[model samples]
Target: MKQFFRLMAALFLSLVLSLAGLAPPAAARGKAPERIPTILISIDGFRPDYISPALTPNLAAIAAKGVSGTMTPSFPTITFPNHWTLATGLRPDRHGVINGAMSDPAHPGVIFGKSSEQPWWWDGSGGPVHVEPIWVAAERAHIRSGIMFWPGSTTAIDGIRASDWQAYHADLPNHERAEVVLDWMRRPANIRPGLALLYFGDVDVNGHRHGPGSPETTAAIRDVDAAIGYLRRGLAGMHRQVNLVIVSDHGMAHTIPDHVIWLKDYVAKEDYALVSYGGILFINNVPGHEAKLAESLKKMPAFIHCWGKGELPERFHYGRNPRVPDWLCLPDPGARIMDGNPEHPNDGGDHGYDPASPDMRALFLATGPAFRSGTHLPVFDNVSIEPLLRRLIGLAPGKDRDGTVAPVEKALR
Candidate 1:
């Protein structure tokens, strides 16, 4: 009789709750908060002016309905450094991937190339401290991430790798790369990645082989735009909304072979080790010849500017890292610093110039439910992208990052 009374009491309570409309809805119970996906795409070396309706109809359509603006790349305005900065929100000085090809004293006689995948080169596994990139942070927070063709993504940074990543293959066609990303997106929500990165090098490659304004470079731009269009159309077919951001590492500048700063004219090859020579030059003076090398560099023509490592302009925010060379040389626009080698020619196009140069400005565009439509944002730094990405993907602000979301908050809905 007592057991029967307990059951009756439970039924009575349920009935009362239903009458009062206090019972939880069947659809609402046990439901989790929705997670919005974010996709970041990089069109390497794409300039802001390259997004005309005729040249890049797909990109122009995105810009018309999304937030569009120019971004100032970090000091040197190179590929690897700025891309790492976009991922980590730290300057090259802090992240330590200083240039495409660079020397590190920690690994004696080892030069890191653009494709170097050693963990120590990126994560500072055996050297300076390591920084956590977006993928690593997302993975730690139980968010699945997919990285492709982003510099440093090939390595297991901070001992953590994204849920899925691909070793960069230059031969992979841009359209196929987009198709691969779409495949990842087609998975069920529980298995799909919350963050995905896509990259295209056709523009940068053509821009370097041909001048930025050449017909070949224009064809490359249109081709990349078509690939992006494919990705956009695929997302629409899936009936899903994702925060999409498109950017470029840096802009390209046309170069003339006649206006080159041949290093042999200024300093002897034996007097210093040429760490890097191109749009920007870095050299390590041999022991006891620092004074001689400095005096010789001072004689370089006015078109080139020379500075000791720590003496870089305050605006550059560089030179603190030990990987930086002892002597740094920056050539003026349209000029290049070369080693005067008959084999290596720099006649096409180059970057890594002064960040303040108009040619160094990069492209930025974003759109999604998280962003306001038809917003025209003012020029901003590329570092701010990390914070904006974190916000879109629901990650908390990182403590060590140098960027804040304030510059891009106006673009958010």
Candidate 2:
């Protein structure tokens, strides 16, 4: 009887010890959930105020279940530079793509595209960007990646796998673009894109064609919301886990026709080549005309701020990239730089502006295991995004690039 009791006690002790060993560590057990297979959806011109219960039920639902905030994109507040900054977690000066259209005086062969046929200026070769993108980081971590229409993604970087990509063509329909992404997700090899980026340009296009607050722009937002709904439903059916981050490159503002500033009127067209987006203008001079043109632009009005390339505001951090033009001009909100070409009139909405303008604030929302419920962060910069993504994918940081800013701690449960 004594021997049998001792054997039973020993067995009980072993069972207790095993159960204790199996218990998760206190920190891990208390740790908030982590999301898997993150998906970043870029709604080209999404504005945070555009989200309403009536306008975007799907996005609102996400807000109810996850976190949302205003993400400030990089300086000049243009598309390509902001998107590249978001991808690499570096400022435009570091990433090299300074504007939608870049002019390289040093290497005349390096020209940015205004049309689809032009080669991508951000071919990862220009000295603009020094860090590897999140896709490259993820791939190095052995994670698969997929991209659709993210501006700087056309030229494949080493270690990253983009199943498909397209040259910048504003002519493509948004639905068709969505269909391509949906189809790519269905492919057996792409069953779960460890990281996926989807871009929708309709809102931005319509906003530029009309105005940001126009009826046409509102309708376009609804269409984009519906498309997002479709993508969410499709992902649900896949029975795979995912983290979906919805963001915008920048916001739009209405520009009055009377508010247009035609640089050609102030400076000889032959003296300066005008490159502009929204109200921000770049003046590239023909040799000796730089000083005269800069002086001429300064006396116009307080509504516009003019600075020589080397003297640009310290906040802009703009001059390091060779693509930046010789002189930078920033107009007040509700103003724009008109194209000198009379054939193309200056009408509609636009984005490029001082990053401080509320109109320039981009949208950011995350839904997945890693995010907390119904959270809101007051504000964050776009450069903070790349670092957050790198952490989720477990990748090492690149040299010389600013590491990820503090994670949206409030956004995670």
Candidate 3:
């Protein structure tokens, strides 16, 4: 009876030790551990204040595990432009994505017809990036990278692309997106991507359809929070180390129907071809109409402001690129601008105002072996993300970037 009991105890101990990989050393045990993979995620329209412990428990937990703080987005505070900033560490002006939709005489099509969704325009098929994005830099260094649905992911920038990439798709579920990225991370080390990016558009979609504080938008926020939690769990289960970074393009703002400013009310339709969305629009005008529209905009300075390409605000760092419009029309805070019957049917929420506005504050959080736990960093500009990302992936940053390393480096462990 004593021998039987001792044998049972020994069997249980061996099983536990084997599962823990502590029973004995294997031949591969002496090999160096793999360089940790880096996963960067973007949640569009995510506000810094949205990470309430009661509601966004997963994200809150991540903040507690690592670093969390405000990430100020670049001006115009729109989608494609700011996403590019995160990737390239260049402002919209320097990156040459001045607006989501605009007419580039060098690559002219229908400005309004394909404003925001034109992959060909952004993907280097029409016009290429002025600065090297980190993905391209990673590829240059012979490191494999993958990106899913990130703005410009489809762009083979300067004849280089992330080894694996997928363009934007509205119908893909968030969990499925996670699965696809995880599969890429699971590849053999010789071929596996060291840097991967994923984007979530659901919160932005709901934020547009419903105001930022609306119950529907809150539910969307919760959905995003849960997706992040699910992705974290899935990676944790893999028993490998991956550095995770969560970022947002910009936040949302409330608006009223009374705030709509129709372009036709100030100038005739033929004066300029307009690409309109809430907050701002690019004006491509007939040569003579440009001056006339400028005068009209001057008269309505209180309601709106227009700047010729040369006269744009210096702080914005816009207007030098040829792809930018002949004139820019900016609306006051809480106001919406439209060329015709509301360019988008969205009624309550809008962005693209001034980045200085508190309403446009974005979110940033990171948790992984690369980051320091229990650290809450100060607010940093979104452009600074590039240098930090390059460091996290163990790559050198491109020289052309305006982003300095001081802002985001403190997040490192």
CA RMSD for every model? 2.5, 6.6, 9.7
Put down candidate 2 lDDT per residue, 119-158, tens digits, no spaces: 3355445574445667767766666777877876766565
| lDDT tens readout by residue for model 3, 113-219 | 21254444554333334566789889988889999888877766667889998866789888888888878877788888899999999888888878788899998
TM-score for each model = 0.93, 0.84, 0.87
Say which candidate scores most in TM-score.
Answer: 1
Ranked candidates (TM-score, high to low): 1, 3, 2
> lDDT values of the candidates?
0.88, 0.75, 0.80
**Top-down lDDT ranking:** 1, 3, 2
Tens digits of lDDT, candidate 1, 1-413 = 99999999999999998886876777767668567899999999999998899989999998999999999999878999999899988888888888888878778888899778777777644434567788898999999999888888988876789999999999999999999889989998898999999999999988878878899999999999999999999999998789999999999989967778788987987789888888889889899898899999999988899999999998998998888899899988678888856344667788889988988899999988999999998888888988888888899998877789988999999
Model 2 per-residue lDDT at 52: 92
